[model samples]
Target chain A: MDPSRLTIAQASAAIAQGSLAPLSLVDSYLERIASLDGELHSYVLVLAEEARERARALAAEPSRGPLHGIPLSLKDIYWTRGRRTTAGSRLCLDFVPAEDAETWRRLEAAGAILLGKNETHEFAIGGPDFTLPFPPARNPWNTAHYPAGSSSGSAVAVAAGLTAGALGSDTGGSIRGPAAFNGIAGLKPTYGRVSRRGVFPLSYTLDHCGPLTRTVEDCALLLQAIAGHDPLDPASADRPVPDYRKALERRLDGMAIGVIRHFHEADAVAGFGPENAPNPAYCAAFEEACRTLEKAGARLVDLRLSPLLDYADANRLIMLAEAFALHETDFQERPQGFGRYAFARIGLGAFFSAADYVEALRARRELCREFREATEGVDAVVSANATAPAPKIDTVPLWGVFERASYTAPYNLLGAPALSLPIGFEDGLPLAFQIAGKPFAESSVFKVGYAFEQATPFHRERPPIAASLPGRT
Target chain B: MAEPIPPDRFTVLVERAGLKLTPEEFEELREGSRFVERMKESVRRSGPREARLRGVTRPREKTAEPAHIFIAGKD
Candidate 1:
């Protein structure tokens, strides 16, 4: 069997049954990365030797758990002790952390082997720019197209089967955007659900550390290991993590899912012409997904809150203000140390006055309350993740992030759990939708996502580029 | 719509923020400020009622709290 293609659940089960050796599984992935990553640019660093060493050790010992010996990569924003953890910027090229990020520490204790570090947008807020220390990861579906970022490489790696799973940070659609573009599963757990201790900060209140995987079940497995309270992280939630895997087995019977249609159909398409509206394929797929959910005994309820632009505005203003506060010293000391995208994007923070920051915060509270009330009648909400498939890499505008309202940003503003999974394909690229739930209601979100995933074949499809690899066929 | 920040005022904000940008960079950022201005206007506008009723306005409650709250000695 080709171990690289196996999901985390399948691989762990094989290992538990003594049918697969951890060393063999790690070797399979290392070989795939060595062959495919040269073109994909998914990994900034590949810990081949370290991964093999851990796999060998695990092969000789008793299995630790479901993730024991599973190879996973982390977005570079995560701190890895003694390893070069460049947040895809020249400024951090030589910087190494003395201690591992809390997430990394937890995953290590759970028997996960580190495959390497995936690339990220600079500081996790910038757009994909070639001038950064590392080349931005390319979409495996079509390398000429962009892989929406800042968790660009994490999603690319998972979708390409270079890594079974990866941990990515989401401040404003960073995780979900790339996941939507790359045809994978990404979960932005409720804010503070996963500890950010030792992870590089973007927007302190908005930053969420979560998993990107090929399947929703793999996302659950990865989240189970790193979730829970961390005393060191001031924002960490001190709540018990439920059995996310167990929750997935429950069908969507009697579940009421809110469909926020205006987010994509009206508000997002308002100013932009027909060419800029959500792809016809995406709209059709969204309707099909709603039908599928209904057939599974879920009740689809139309819901509306504030306009998508309102959430986008608040999320952006707050993120820029907080990010600027964190990097003010650097901007002042060595303004040229940053990439053009990072400098330009983060510099916008300077324009926001202290009053603007506070006002944005107040608006965020109201928006969150509005979302809670709107979603109160539903078990979860479903909406578009990316309005369209991946665009041409060179065609992306520098300020494109601000040019459109984001469907994923609404959940970020509300601090709710959101899962992005493939819903369909268009022009050989992926189209995805998000299932979001109330704060700390990750299990319900996962239940809806898992049910839809099991009912569809989208998640099982792989990129043609990956399938064309020398050993893949 | 909010007016753009005047060049002199923009310069003052940049200097106050301690950012030293090349002329070209400064020009680009100055142009980019329109997006920020738009966001500022969106947030400064009155709450949900104003969104639904464009001409209607209401005073924000004094007791409405920001999303973040201070917890003493948690660390």
Candidate 2:
């Protein structure tokens, strides 16, 4: 495989064996980023010299870890010491943190090379705002379509082979949305599984840090390097960090899979896409994914919980309330610093009374309890991540987030582990389904995601834009 | 959905929030309030009414220090 196309594990193995030097790997990616990122807009800032210097240093040393010599991009929200962390907003264009985000520190310790800062939805809740200092990431599958965000650039980088894997934070499906849209694997680990210290806050209670990568195993590898307790992060889980890559070795045989069929089927509000009718492709792909699991020795059971709208409502209220709290002063003082979509979305928070915010929290507990009770019989729940493939970028409305009920939001609200993996495609764009597990049961989520990845050939199909890149063998 | 917050009340809330939205922006927000109203209704419907009442009716325990700050997935 071309160096850029190689999974983290494959590249690590090659690098460890000295067949591929870290410098060469970084160079290959930099070359590809140079060639593709102009069109893809996957990176906001390219730290070419820093990346090359880090790669050269790694090339001289023995492997520090599985992530040693690997090149990765951080969503611009992750504070990198002395590097501009724009959080995809013009307001923070000059902002640079003196310390690295805990995840960034951990990855750097694992010998990962910094590729650049990937673009994001402003403050992770903004729209695909073109008015921001940086352009929104273009979907590598089809440049004209929306790469579901706010981890837009992170997914684009991985899908287009601009970076090996990228760190993406999910407040409400940001990581998984882009992963699904771009045809890659995205894992939003159980809340607090990865520390959020030094990452710009989106929703303090709801935000989750995770990864987007080319494969389930790669996702596990990236998570392994980043997941740990940080004393500075109040929500950081102090539980023992499991060997995620080793956990991937386990088979999915005999695992009980709960299929949340109604979320996407009946409740999903199709927003921008031309297809208002039920997406037959998505329906067929989801059914095929279930069959793939069954063939892999997993038992599929139909499971229903609270209506998707209920979860969406609770999640939106909490996120908006919390995000507004975080940026309230700024929103008041200089609302012009924010993009129109971000301002409009965050502005909704102004109307929510303290009673409303508290009520949402109470409702959150109820919904989470329901989900927990519903999933007790099953190891994980499978559902469509997005209603369809990427929509036209311009077609996404400013109110789209409020207008739709997400398959991914329930997991966000539950603070559970959810993985979005490509199942198939429609109109040459990827379609995905999420495997959600109980809080802290990322092992189960990865097991199911890996089994599905192995049984299907969807992961093997690269975006045509990437395949057509000159000099790619 | 809960009845739309009257424009006068909405204006007060925006002023308290210190946001300076133009009339055009406020009009757009007025339109968007329908979504928020629907969401508020859903949350209210879903909330545990008894829990809220109990929270208000039975507030006794007072601690000098905050509750334990254990993280999720940890003891």
lDDT, candidate 1, residue A128? 83
- RMSD of every candidate to native, in Å, equals 1.6, 4.5
Question: Candidate 2 on A171-274: residue-level lDDT in tens?
Answer: 88999999999999999999889999999998988899999999999999989888888878988888998877666743577789999886776555422123
Docking tier of model 1: it is: medium
Off by over 4 Å in 2: A249-251, A269-277, B1-4, B47-75
Q: Please write out the lDDT profile of model 1 over residues A84-121, one tens digit for every residue.
A: 98888888999899999999999999999999999999
| Candidate 1's iRMSD | 1.6
Error of 2 at A33 (Å): 1.2
Error of 1 at A372 (Å): 1.4
Top candidate by TM-score: 1
Candidate 1: which stretches are off by over 4 Å? A271-276, A468-473, B1-4, B53-57
Clash totals, every prediction: 0, 0
